[model samples]
Target: MSEQLMVVGEITAPHGVKGWVRVRPETDLDQLAGIKRCRLFWPDNKERLFEVEQVRPHRQIWLLKLKDVSSRDEAEALRGALWMIRRDEAPPLPEGHYYVPDLVGLEVVTVQGESVGEVSEVLFGPANDVFVVRRSGLPDTLIPAVREVVKEIALNQGKIIIDPLPGLLD
Candidate 1:
C-alpha cells in the first residue's frame, strides 16, 4: 500500500545538552504514548526516517530521542521539522469520531437544503473545534463544532448538513 503520511507532532525546540528534542504532540497525550517510530520531513521536502529511541513525559512537552540524533546541536537543527508517520501506523478511532482531514472539502448545506458553503478548514480551539466555511457570496463563517449546529456529518458522502442557529449566517 502507498504510504499515507500524517503529521503527528512538531519539533518545538531542542532539549538539553543532548540531542533530545522537545515535541508538541498533535495527538492526545494518551495517543502519543504508543508512537515508537516516525518520519521526519524537512521544510525543504527532505525526509528522514527515525526510530524512537526514547519517549518520556516532561510537563507539557514530550522529550524524545531519535536513533540517530545524539547531541543538542543535531536536535536543534531539526527544530520546526514536522514529525509524520504512515496513517496505518495510527491506531483505530472510535465510532462517530473523525480526523480533521476527513472534514475538509465536505459540502455544507442548511437543513432547508440551501447550500451555505463548504468546509474549508477545521480550526482547533480551547473548548471545541470550529469549522471554517467558505461561501460563494458571503464572507467566511465560523461554525461551532457542536452536534446541534452540525446536525449531521456524512464522511462517505462528503457532505455535512447543519441546522445553523439563528443569526449564524449573519
Candidate 2:
C-alpha cells in the first residue's frame, strides 16, 4: 500500500478540435480506459482530479475525452499533462513482471552468487528494457532484461539473479 502515484498515460496533443486529446498510454488501453477517475499532472507542476468521459483507440494511440473539457482550447491546454494513478490502484501485472518502482534499488547479482551491483534505473528500449546497475568503483553495467540474462527476480529477497551473457557485465 504505497502512497506513491505512478504515471500511466500522457496527453500528447489535441485530436480533432472536438475536445478529444491523443493520449500515449503506458499500460494496456483497456485498463487505462477502465479507470473512472485519475490525477492529471500538468506541465507547470499543477495537479487536479478529472473524470473520464470517453476513451477510444485511434490507430496506434488513444483518444481521450475528459469531463469539463468540451472545447478544443480546453483540450489543447492539457497538452503535456500526465495521467497518474495510485500505486495500489494499478492494474495487476502478469506473472514474472515487476513494476519499475519495485525493481529500482534491488540488488543485482550473478547466478553463481557473485555480487554485481544495485539496479539504479531501468531503461525501456526499443527491443527490451535494460537494467542499469551501479557498482562501487566500476562503471555502470547495462543488463538487457531478457529471459537468458534475467534468470530470476527474487523480489522477496530484494535481489535479481542474472546469468550475464559473456561481455554483458563489462
Candidate 3:
C-alpha cells in the first residue's frame, strides 16, 4: 500500500446474511465508528474503495456494513481484506503516545551509547508494552516499556534509548 495509507482493520468473516462483515479493528471503537471511507486491500494487491455504511461493536469484534457489499457471499469474498485509511485521516494521538506502527523497527541503544539491537516486536502486556530487541548471535532481549526503562524515543533519528536494569544486557 502507499505510505499515505495505514491499515486500520481487517475483514475476518461474514457477519449476518446481510452485507455486514466481522472486522478485527486496530483502531478504537470511537475512531472506527467515525470512519466514512475505507480502502479494502484484496488478493494480488488489488484494492477497492468502500463507503462505510455502518459500524457496530459485536463482542470482541466489529460488524461493518460497507456500500456495495450487500450480500453474505460478497462479504465472504472480502475475508482477509485489509481496511485502510489515509494516515492524515487518523485522529491525533495524545502527547507521549506513539502508534505501534511508528515504533516498530527502531534501533535500540543504551544510555551510554551501547548498541543493543533493533526492535523486532512490541508485545502488549497487561501492565505495559514490552520491546523485543533482536541482537546478533543472541536471544531476543525483552525490555519493559516503562518510563524508567525506556528513557527516550527519538523517532526522527530512528532510535530508542533505554536505561536498562542491572544485568539486563548480560
Candidate 4:
C-alpha cells in the first residue's frame, strides 16, 4: 500500500446548529460505517484528528458530528475541509478488489506490454468505474473498470494491463 493518507470524505456544509457537518463520502457506505475517527485536512495542509460523535445518513451525503466542534460557526469553519484516514486504518478490500486511490498513477500498459499512460482519474458510475489515462500531448484514454477490459492490476509493481476494445483509444 502507498504511504500517503487517503481522503475518504469532504465536509461540504454545516448541518444544524449543533456542530454537525454534511459530508460527501468518497467511499462506499460500508467503508464509511467503519470510520470512527479521522484526520481533518485543511487547505493549508494542516491536519488534526477528531473523534466521531455521531454519524447518520442524509439524502445523498452523511451528517457527522465531531467531538470538539460545538457550534454552527465551528462547523461552518470546517467547510471545504477533507476527512482522511491513514492507509493502514482504511477498511480492508475484499478479494480481487482494490481502492480507487491505489489505481491512480499506475502505469497503464497493453496486454502485449505497450505503454499507454498513467491513470489520472477514476470516474465511478452506476454501472462501473472508468479510468482516465493521461500521456503528454495526447488526449486522455478512458478505460472501463471491468474484468474484460482491465485484465490485471499489479499494484505492487505499479502497473495495469488492459485490453482495449475497438476504437477505445481513438
Highest lDDT among the candidates is held by which one?
A: 4
Candidate 3 versus truth, CA RMSD in Å, comes to 3.0
Ranking by TM-score: 4, 1, 2, 3
Candidate with more favorable, higher lDDT: 3 or 4 = 4
**Residue by residue across 1-170, what tens digits does model 1's lDDT show?**
67777777799899997789998866544555566788888889988889988878787678889988988889998999998888777666677666665677899988899988899887766677788999998899999988889888888788889999999989
Pull out the clashing pairs in model 3.
none
Residue 65's lDDT within candidate 4 is: 92
Give the least accurate 10-residue stretch of model 2, judged by summed lDDT.
25-34
Better of 3 and 4 by TM-score: 4
Per-model clash counts, in order, read 2, 0, 0, 0
Best by TM-score: 4
Per-residue C-alpha lDDT of model 4 across residues 18-66, encoded as one tens digit per residue? 8999998776555656667889988998878999888787877889899
Output the TM-score of candidate 3.
Answer: 0.77
Model 3 is weakest, by summed lDDT over 10 consecutive residues, at 25-34
lDDT of 2: 0.85
lDDT of 2 at 23: 86
Those runs of model 3 whose alpha carbons end farther than 4 Å from true positions after fitting are: 25-34, 53-60, 167-170
Listed in order, each prediction's TM-score against the native is 0.80, 0.79, 0.77, 0.85
Q: Is candidate 1 or candidate 2 better by TM-score?
A: 1
